[model samples]
Target chain A: MSTLIDILLLSLMGITALAAVRMKSLFGAVMLTGIFSLLSALWFLILDAVDVSFTEAAVGAGISTVLMLGTLSLTKSEEKTSNHSQIIPLFVVFVTGGVLIYGTLDMPDFADPLAPIHTHVAPHYIEKSGAEIGVPNIVTSVLASYRGFDTLGEVTVIFTAGVGVLLLLGIGRRREDGDE
Target chain B: MTHHFILRVITKLLIPLILLFALYVQFHGDFGPGGGFQAGVIIAAALVLYALVFGLNTASAVIKEWVLLVLIPLGVLIYAGVGVASLLLGGNYLDYNVLAHDPVHGQHLGILLVELGVGMTVAAVLTTIFFAFAGRGHRDANGNLLPHSALSDEIRNRKDGQP
Candidate 1:
């Protein structure tokens, strides 16, 4: 059942990607990308990574869609036709994709108990997180407690991104202008 | 926008619920499929929807840019403050075991506080970015989009010209 769902979702995702790539309108491409994010989010849920899926849906599907639309509004909505050849880029992409797929062949089966991830700290986190952190969600325990520093860095990155955008593009002076 | 009456009405109704859900996700992260990051984005999304419906000016009035600027760093401060606090208590940096007599209880408290900090920062940062992007080139009273100024034309040309 899960495999069937996975196949369906993957097929839909491929279709969305192709459609997005072929799309001429930035608006259409952005919308397709949002659809792609939502589909991947659902796939993550099926894999039981609810936290990752939720973050993907919110950030990728929701916030990014808005941001991309804002970007589109600022620029031309249609792609400018380029006479440049795409052969080299396409060949490079194909080669990279082949290499990645070849590399993944050595990975252990899905949810393999003997996998390095399962044998190492994951079990310890699962076993001791309840008593140590007392959080019902083990992901939360690991994120906010065991891996708290990483999260701090992530927050700092977000802060830095906001500051960068503000520096590059100052906030709108529209409100004050209206009052005058 | 004014003509999109149904959209305006539906957005007005959904904004409160979206905000309430964000709060739920924020506090319930420890027990649910969400956390500070998701909740923060959700909250910003609510504001974004409002801006789309009522106009950017109305949304900016609702949340002053200065307020967002303060909020951005304040969240990181809260998160790091907790770490510093734990350090002051002599349990290493971010070692919440020293927060209370019961180590588990202390961890919970620490997690809640850090998550709050993360939520605040994420929400503020995202909203600020949106304001920056949307407000940089704004609309006139007729609701037509306008570039910031003659200077913005040069900026946009450079931006779009780049690969």
Candidate 2:
């Protein structure tokens, strides 16, 4: 029964991905992409990466959908049909997907206790984090401390994105005449 | 089109609770599934709801654009400042242990400060994006930027028999 459910979910994810790319209406595509993100989040949860799943659900399904819709509001709703099938993009996607799938074949099975990831840095963090940081959530400790530099970089990236949007929109610009 | 008794009463009751819940989430993130980002979005959503029901102009009065502009950078500075503080205390960057003489207390303080910063930035940025989209004077085929708004307005206009 569980296997059946897994297969169903996987198929649903595939269909959602296809729909997200192939939909003619831009709004429909964006919404379907959100569904794709949601499905991927569920997949992550099933794989026991609860923290990753939460981040995916929030940033992917929530923020990405909102950002896409905002962009859609500023542009056309319907994708223009071209004579060509966009061979370059198709080739790029195919190559990337093939490489990703090939790479996954060498990875340990999902949720494997003996996985290298579980044996290596993770176990050290899991065992020592409590004594070192006194934090129950090791993920938080790792994010804010052991990997503090990376977190700083991530925050900087977010700030940069915010600045990029502000520059592009000119939402808070002052007029040359200083008029409201 | 005018004020309704039920909505006015409900909104008045709900706004405070939403804000309180946001603060709770911001502080409780250390122990739970929520943190600054979620709290910020929830608060922004509540404000957006108020704006939607009242008017953009009215909401802007409560949360001025200038205030939001300041908040964006303020949150980032607050977050980075904590790290700087930690560095100044003779630890690596963002080493919260140096935030106070007692490492545990310092961690707690650091977490709270960063969470507050994250919440403020998230809320401000989300609302800013919402306002940018909603404030744009554009109309689709149904004469609304959003389908949900169009449907609600259609229902309201039909009740009022507006041209």
Candidate 3:
């Protein structure tokens, strides 16, 4: 039953992706991308990665949609057709996709017990986090305590991204002032 | 939006609920699926929604630009401060085990404080970005160029049923 739902959701995601790519209106494409993010979030939920699902829903669906809409207001709603040929781009995409698929061939089967990730420090986290951290959520314990430095780095990265956006958009400068 | 009675009423009712939910997700993250990142986005979304309908000036009145600017770095400092505190207490950087007499209690305290810092930084940063995007090329109530105006012509066009 779950597999069927996964298949359905995956197909829907593919359809949404194609629609977003083919859509002429940037607004519609943006909305389709939001739908795509929502479907991906659902897929994450199905995989029992609830934390990932929450981030996907909030960042991808919520924040990105609003930001894209803001961008659209500053630019044209309809994408302008370019005289440039698509053949080279299409060829490049196919090559990249093929290489990515080839790379994945060496990856372990999904959820394999012998996978490196499962064998790695995960066992210790699974067995010891509860007693050591006194937290029911192992994911939080691993993120905040076991790998706290990494979490700090991630937060710093987010802060940097925000600062970068503000810089590019001219946070303190008014548009009317024409100050670069 | 100011002219829309129904929207104004609905927004007034919904903003508090959204903010409350964000806080719930932030503090309850230890036992649940959400964390600082999710809570921050949700809280930023609530503020953005309010700004969208109530105008940027109103939102700014609620949360000033200086406050956001200060908060962005303050959160990171809080997170780093905890690590420094642990280090001074004879633990490695970010090692929460030595934060208190009992390692478990220290871990809990450290996690809670760190998450709060993350939440504060994320919320402030996102809100600042949204303000930067939405406030460009708009005027304030005083007819001055509002540094963080929430006016978007596309939004107005959509609201008016135009393409």
Top lDDT: which candidate number? 1
Q: Write model 1 residue lDDT over A35-154, tens digit each, in one string.
A: 999999999999899989988998889889999999988887899778889999999999999999999899998768798888888889989888889999999889999999999999
Q: Highest TM-score among the candidates is held by which one?
A: 3
Error of 3 at A47 (Å): 0.7
DockQ of each: 0.46, 0.19, 0.49
DockQ of 2: 0.19
- State residue A52's C-alpha deviation in candidate 2, in Å: 4.1
Supply the DockQ value of model 3: 0.49
lDDT of 1 at A13: 96
- Pitting candidate 2 against candidate 3, the one with the higher DockQ is 3
Instruction: Return whichever of 1 and 2 wins on lDDT.
Output: 1
Error of 3 at A159 (Å): 1.7
- Whole-model lDDT per candidate: 0.87, 0.74, 0.87
Tens digits of per-residue lDDT for model 3, A32-105: 99999999999999998998898888888988899899989988899988899999999999999999999999
Candidate order by decreasing lDDT: 1, 3, 2
Alpha-carbon shift of residue A159 in model 1 (angstroms): 0.6
Selected candidate, larger DockQ, 1 vs 2:
1
RMSD of each: 5.5, 7.0, 4.8
Q: Over the stretch B1-163, how does candidate 3's per-residue lDDT look in tens digits?
A: 4498898899899999999999998899999877787888889989988888887778888998778989999999999999999989999999998998999989999999999999999999999998888876565333333443245653464468643
Q: Which 10 consecutive positions of candidate 3 chain A have the poorest summed lDDT?
A: A171-180
Instruction: Give all TM-scores, in the order shown.
Output: 0.89, 0.78, 0.90
